[model samples]
Target: MVSKRLFQSVAEQIAELIDEGAYPPGTRLPGERELAEKLGVSRVTIREAEIALQAVGRLEIKTGSGVYVSERKPASLGALPQASAFEVTEARLMIEAESAALAAHNITDEAIDELETLVNQMSSDDEGVANAADERFHLTIAQASNNAAMVHTIQSLWQMREQIPEVKATYEAVCVHDAKSRTDEHRAIFDALRARDPGAARQAMREHFQRLLESMLEATERKALEEVQLRASQSRERFLAAAKFG
Candidate 1:
């Protein structure tokens, strides 16, 4: 019998294949029997693997048709540098505080106008549009800093958030919890920058990340509690079964 973990391993392998363009977007995946034969796993295991990928928005299942790769692929699920949401937020606090301070000194009227536009877009009710605008707003600040290296560094960090599945998952969960607060935080940062107050900008940036760190800790604790409860329930079920058998 294949272990439960094997299902996840198989899912990761399939995700790698998708990442490598072996199965491009909108392409139909091979049947479960074919995948089982190719991977030396049972059909049931293949089904579980497909389910895992589907959960992350990597695959689309069409009833009466077939499984196809989703147009929007998820972050690579394979082995990659995994950073906790807190660590990413911590790194942002360090780097972005300085970026915001520099932007306050070097930002032009044109950049401020652009930032205002992005902030308005971020306040929209649409999550996707708001999220994209949020990213652009930060990158715009990096650009205003007039440091090519800082721009490159900040862009690289954002790309990592997109490419690492665990980080993306954690951040998505956090976003869902308190997204409205982020708009207010961005506004505070913008206000400090517009006033050309470097110290205020830096403080605002740091406070934004401090809130994120607190949220991450709360989410982590809640997840741990859920897992503990699940394990306890499983143990109780096993005990009852064994008692009945004895």
Candidate 2:
């Protein structure tokens, strides 16, 4: 199905192309003038898309040269800054998979202790504190991967979550179920990490983040859309009042 979202459509199209191997990792994309011509969008739109893609670690734009696809596909894609809920999922799928794998090899006693502390911190009597600590726990996991870039990219998701109020609310609500699933997932991931099994660690990370991704995507974005209507009404009122005053 064609995406009704214009910019998102543009981003997804590129993301899919990379996934399908049509764009191929480490290959350079056409220049802005050429891409805009091909994409049938203004160069400005192309520029915006590139930045958005870059934020999520998808495409690397070299001003002196051209835009080139990064060596890592899924991780690179994850590193790109998230522009939407789907993008966040895309990034999580890409980065966290590798994150889990690396954590399996990198886990130290200190890291394990930190994880336990985070589990305790997750119970934030206050939601704001909870979210903050929750993000910190995830960030610590990503950092444990020993990949600086991955850590930075995953951290970016914290800001993206702010824009996604629905995701925050829904996930927070889900955390109420004895918080068993969450603790279990963290324990499973720790088990893998302690064993130094890369594949299992990655798998655990995937399952946990995938649940979150699914829940967020299921949340209808009607609230944000409704705000558009409110803005329109305020704009019209201001215009009419201006005409009457004049």
Candidate 3:
């Protein structure tokens, strides 16, 4: 069974495609069965995704007819940077590692405690709660850097993470398979910060993203391989967009 947020990710993917003109305004989307097969998800997930897109005015669903892309684009789409998951991850690795190092030196005991709480919260069964806590955990460390510029930069990266459909989908897919690894990595970084070890903190943060990047590659390759016999070009193109990092 998929998490509640999986359909949101699917909705984002459809919206992104519409925005990119793959499905132009007024273009009818494929049937739920086709989309489900293409995305390797349940038909119920496709239905939920379409309903979500319709609710956001990105699509129009007719009772007898099919879902069509809306001509009216979302206002916030233009504000988000056009970046792939790999680019976003790469940026986070470079910027956040330094932020973690600085945070190790500057973080207060209370902030450390807060991070510990967030780390524990990440182990929650509720995906929404765990995801929110994960964001807070990183932001707390970024804030601990005591550098406004660093904090702003980290915030922007996270905005890219959350707002970009492909990035968000890729992350959700990888995260679903590695929740334990993610929590352990966060703990390592938290431990480094608590010890006030800048070098260790930097290394821990780097290791976290490094593992994330590697996992993304593995997931992308695996999915592409699974779908290649059916839609080799399309599957490869989609996964490659998310797996561009070294």
* Cα-based TM-score, every candidate: 0.66, 0.50, 0.64
47: Cα error in model 2, Å:
36
Candidate 2, 39-153: lDDT as tens digits: 7875545655665575567876543356778675434322334266666666777887898788778766776776666666566565444444455456667767888778666
Order the numbered candidates by TM-score, best leading. 1, 3, 2
Candidate number achieving the greatest lDDT relative to the actual structure: 3
Give the winner by lDDT: 2 or 3.
Answer: 3
The better candidate by lDDT, 1 or 3, is 3
Of models 1 and 2, which has the larger TM-score? 1
lDDT per prediction? 0.80, 0.67, 0.83
Q: By the TM-score metric, which is better: model 1 or model 3?
A: 1
Residue pairs with backbone atoms closer than 3 Å in model 3 (clashes) = none
- Model 2 segments beyond 4 Å from truth? 1-82, 163-180, 221-246
Ranking by lDDT: 3, 1, 2
Question: Which segments of model 1 are wrong by more than 4 Å?
Answer: 1-80
For candidate 3, give the lDDT of residue 154.
Answer: 80
Question: What TM-score does candidate 3 reach?
Answer: 0.64
